[model samples]
Target: MTPEEILPDDLMERIRGRAAGYDQDNSFFHEDLAELAAAGYLKVFVPVPDGGLGLGLEAAAALQRRLATAAPATALAVNMHLVWTGVAHVLAARGDDSLGFVLKEAGQGEVFAFGISEAGNDSMLFDSGTTATPEGDGSYSFTGRKIFTSLSLGWTRLGIFGKDAAARNGDGELVFGFIGRETPGHETLTDWNTLGMRASQSNTTLLQGAVVPPERIFRKLPVGPNQDPLVFAIFACFETLLAAVYTGIGERAFTLALEAAKHRTSAKYGGRSYAQDPDIRWKIAEAAMAMDGIQPQLASVARDVDALVDHGPQWFPKLVGLKVRATENARAVVDIAVRVSGGSSYFRGSELERLYRDVLAGIFHPSNEESAHSTVANAWLGPLEM
Candidate 1:
């Protein structure tokens, strides 16, 4: 089904109406979350037999793009849950049912949030500063802090990982697992006040000594990047879904610029609409062209993931490139939209103002600018000599 059919225009309008208020109050999108859950949006990536829409990655990305057009913060936060479900689908398709339970729980209305991000851990999933101590009973205790834990106020389960320096003959192993919100030693700090995307409530989390049973400890790979299906699934879902959100931001900004250009009249132009002004039209066109290039790239990467197209070493480059393009293009579009809309968009409450802040958050996500460039460089040029 099309994204419009899945999310519908009226739902988007309602969500859009509340976005500004949520930003103003630095609040979570509780009402929007409830509405989305009721619509089964959270289950978009779960299997059909599991009571979800069973959408492929491409279709899910489209829906996320549409969702973000109305409420980027809400869509960004929801992407966490979708990422896990998407990861589960990816694993299942590859004959690895390790995360099958995630899909099942999602179908049953359980919310899962990503908790892998850590302060100063620039290596992203490849390495961790947190400690995962293995217990004699095959369980592990995680003791470290996690930053940017989206859906922090509402998630039932949080997927996290850390390194066990003593495991695998002191070579160090990365332990992946999930723990409940009420799990002992897990603390969610009320520290989400941010410049944008405030509704996401992506607060810092402190894991003093959270335990994960054996069944929950899914993977125990070496301390760096490897040929693991888990790695592939995480990168594929995270990068693709993130790109979709930013693409939607750019799409919305482009539309707003078009509307502004058509409606606003310039007295200096003798009552002609700004749409008739050469400079305004040029800015609008430039934003449109840049924004137009993002959609197909988002769709192709997502489709490749769903189809298991083997890019091999090129996969990371492709994923990171799509994310960087979408985010940077979205920022440009928002800038053009603000310019084309005149000083009115610069007001404290204008949608463009909030979006400007929200779009900036994209740069700080995984596969950041420097890391993305390095990944592409390494993929083509190989690691630096020595």
Candidate 2:
């Protein structure tokens, strides 16, 4: 189904109307979450037979882009849950049923959140600062701090991983598992104030000996990176969905700029609309041109993932490259939009102003500018010399 069918214009408008209040209060999108859950948006990746829409990555990305236009924070926070379900689908399609339960739980309305990021842990998925201790019953107890845990207020299940320092005969192993919200030894900190994307309320989570039963324990890979399907699935889904949200931000900003240009008149030109001004038109054209290039790239990458096109070694570069381009392009588009939008965008509560702040968050997500460049460089130039 089309994005419009899933999120009607009226529903989008209501969500757009509340974006400002949520940002201003620095609160979570509780009402938006409820509405989205009732709409079955939370189950977009689960198979139709399992009570979900059974959408592919391309379709899910489209829906997320559309949703971000209305409420970026809401879209971003919700992306966490979609990532897990999307990962499950991707893995299962590749003949790996280890994470099949994730899909089943999602179909039953379970909310999943990612818990991979950490403080000063630049290794990302390759390694972890968290400690994982085997409980001798096939279970593991994780003790570490996870930051930027979006959906912090609402996640029923959190996917986390840590290092089993004693495993692999002193080499080490990374244990992956899922823990419930009601699980003891975990705390969600109430510290989410930020420069932008405030409504996401992506607070820090302290996992103090949180345990995941054997049934929930999934993969246990070597210490460093390897050709693992789970690794590829997580990176693919996470990067693609994230790029979609930022692309939506740019799309909305461009629309608002166009609207502002057509309506606002310049007294210096005898009340002529800014749309007639050469410079204003040029700026709008630049924003449009930049936005035009992103949609196709985003669509192509997501579609390739869904189709299982074997990019092989180039997949990481493509995934990280798309993320960087979409994010940087969106940020640039928002800046141009603000310039063409005049002084009103400078004031608080204006959609453009909120977007200006929201778009800045693109720089902070994983596959960040530096890391993205490094990944692409490595893909083409090989690793750095000693």
Candidate 1 lDDT, tens digit per residue, 1-386?
78887788899999999999999999999999999999989999888898999888999999999999999999999999999999999999999999999999999999999999998999788899999998989999999999999999879999999999998889999999999977898999999999999999999999999999999999999987798999989999999999999999999998889999999998999998998999997998799789768888899999999898999999999999999999998999999999999999989999999999999999999989999999999999999997
Report lDDT (Cα) of residue 230, candidate 2: 95
Go through the candidates in order and give the C-alpha RMSD of each one to the true structure. Answer: 0.8, 0.7
lDDT by residue (1-386, candidate 2, tens digit) is 88999999988999998899999999999999999998999999999999999999999999999999999999999999999999999998889999899999999989999999999888899899999999999999999999999999989999999999999999999999999989998999999999889989899999999999999899999988899999999999999999999999999999998998999999977899999999999999999999999999999999999998999999999999999999999999999989988998999888989999999999889989999989999999999998
lDDT of each: 0.93, 0.94
lDDT of 2 at 304: 96
If scored against the real structure, what TM-score would every candidate get? Answer: 0.99, 0.99
Error of 1 at 378 (Å): 1.1
Quote model 2's TM-score. 0.99
Show the colliding residue pairs in model 2: none
